[model samples]
Target: QAGPGTIGRIVRVLLAEWNRFGQQVMMDGRVIQRGWRETQRGFDDRVGLFWRYGTGINLDGDDTDHPWSAAFISYTMRTAGVPDHLFPRSRRHSTYIHFAQQNALVNDPDTAFIAHRLEAYAPKVGDLVAYTRSGAANYDRYVNRARYKSHTDIVTYVHHGEIGVIGGNVADSVTLKRLKRGGAGRLIDDSHAWFAVIENRLPLR
Candidate 1:
C-alpha cells in the first residue's frame, strides 16, 4: 500500500499538468478573476466544467444505501492523470444498486469493491465527476437523479452563479429537502462531499 503522504505526491503531479493547461486558458483569455487575491483555485474545482454527486455503503446497517462523497476527490484524481494502476476503474457495488441488482449480489456486499480496472487514469478539465454517495458505496438512481436533477456530467466552467450554492446540493440532499418543505420538514441528514475550485483558494480544505 502507498504511504500516508502518497496523495500529496499525486497532487503535485496533477498541479504540474494543470499549470500547463492554465497557460492555454490564459492565452485564450478564459481565466476568471476572483474577487479575493490571497486564494488559489484548484484544477478539479476550477476546471471550466465539473460535476457533483454522492455514493455510499451501509453506514448504520439500515439497509438504506444513501449518498456520500469520498469518490469526489478520488474520481477527480483518476480523471486528472494520477495513473490508472493507482486508481483503477472498479465497479462500485455498494454505490450502484442497479449494478448490484443486475449482478444479483448480496444487498450488503463488501463495503468497497472495485469491479473494472482502468488502464489509464487522467482526469481532464471536462472529465465526468462523481463522489462517494455516502462515503461507503450505496447510491440509488432515484436519489442521485434527484440530487443532480438540474445538472449534467459535462461541466463547462465554474461560476459564482446560483450553481455555487446548488452545486453542493448533490452531496447534501437535506439542503434540497429543506428548500422543498418550506423549511419545515425533517431532512434526511447525510454527510456531504464537495469538490470545487476557487481561483486562488486551495481545492482540498
Candidate 2:
C-alpha cells in the first residue's frame, strides 16, 4: 500500500495534467482562447494505451465517431501511478465506475473510493464526477460505464458555487468545466447529465 500522503500526490498529479491540457473558462467550463482545435488532437497522444500499448491513430479530437474520454481518464490515473488493483486501466468509463461501485457497496474502508449520488456529495479536488449525458434518471440502475454513454471529469479546483473539473472529449478536446453548486456548496442541477461523484477517500489519508 502507498504511504499516508499518497492521495495528495495523486491529486497534485491530476491537477498538473489538467494544467498541461490547457487553460479553461471557469465561468462556463470550456477553453476559450487556447485554440479549441488543440482539444481535438490530445487523444492521439494516448492512442497507444487504447491499442494495447501500441501506437495511437492520428485521428482528430472532433471525430465524434470515436470517443476517447474514457481513455483520457485512464491515462490520467495510470500516469499518476495509481495502484492497478485500486483502479482499473480501462477504455470504458463503465469499467472503472463499476470498480468504484463494487467497492462502495462492500463498504470497503481499506480502499480509497466511495460512490455517492450527485446531490449527496460535495466533490473535492481529485474526486471524479461521472455523468449520464443523456439526462437519464435511472443512472443508479446501470452498474457499468458501458451500460450507458457516460462521461467523467476530475475535480481540479473548487471556488464559490463551482467545482472546477477537467476531462477529455468535451468540446472535442480535454476541457475544464466549472460546475455550478448551491448555496450550501452542493451541486445544483446544471442540466448536463451529471449523476454521481466518486469521492476519492484515499485523498483523505
Candidate 3:
C-alpha cells in the first residue's frame, strides 16, 4: 500500500527539486522551470527514448536499459514507503519516466538528477549500462569491428546472486548474447566487460 499523504509529499518534493536545482528559462521576463523531455538515440531503425532538460539528460538505450530504469523507479517507491509494484515494469522501448501532468514538466537537470538518484532504493538485475562520453571517434571503430566480427551491445544479467556485465568493442549491437557467451567461452583474452558479486545492495541515491 502507498501512503497517500506521503506520495503527495514526495511529488511535491520532486517538483520543488525541479523548480530549484533544475534548469530555468526566461520567457517574457518571467523565469520558468523546465522538467523533462524525451530524447532519441540511434535513428529511425534503432531509436530509443531518454529524459532530458537543459543540458542534462539520460538516454534510455545507451544511457542504461529497461531493467536499470525499473530498479531506479522501484527504489524511489521504496524510499517513499510505497509498494514496490507501484513502479511497474515497462517494456524495453517504453519511456523511462512518465508523468500525468505535462504543464509542470520540463525536461531538465532536476529530472535527470532525481532519476539517477532512485537507483539507491530498489536495485535489481539484468540491467543495461552505458557511459556518458561525447564524441564519434570510436564510432567508426566499433562499427568496423561489428562489420568484421560480431555485433552486440554491452550489457549483463545479474542471475543467481552473481552479477555479469558484458563488454564488447563492436558496433551495431542491441543485445548482450554475444558478450555473455564469448566471455564465458574465453574466446577473448581481456574484456572491458565486468562481472562481480553484489557485496553492497545500497541504491545509488
> Which structure among the candidates has the greatest TM-score?
2
Residue 130, model 3: Cα distance from true site in angstroms: 25
How good is model 1 by TM-score?
A: 0.24
**Residue 162 in model 3: shift from native, Å?**
48
**Candidate 1 residues 88-191, lDDT tens each?**
32224123322323222343333121121111221222222233333432333323222231121212223222111111113221011111111222111222
lDDT (Cα atoms) of all candidates against the true structure? 0.25, 0.65, 0.26
Show where candidate 3 strays beyond 4 Å: 23-76, 89-205
User: What's the alpha carbon RMSD for model 1?
Assistant: 16.7
- Every model's TM-score: 0.24, 0.79, 0.23
- Candidate 3 residues 1-205, lDDT tens each? 4544543443333333223323323222133433222122332112132122211234343443322322222333344454433333222111222220111134332221112111222213323322212232122222212112111121233343223332211121211222222323321212332211111111223
lDDT (10s digit) by residue, model 2, range 95-202: 777778777779878877667777777888788988775557454676544455777888877888888777766665556677897877676746476777888865
Between 2 and 3, whose TM-score is larger? 2
Q: Which ten residues in a row have the lowest lDDT in candidate 1?
A: 173-182
Off by over 4 Å in 2: 26-43, 46-64, 144-146
Whole-structure CA lDDT of model 3: 0.26
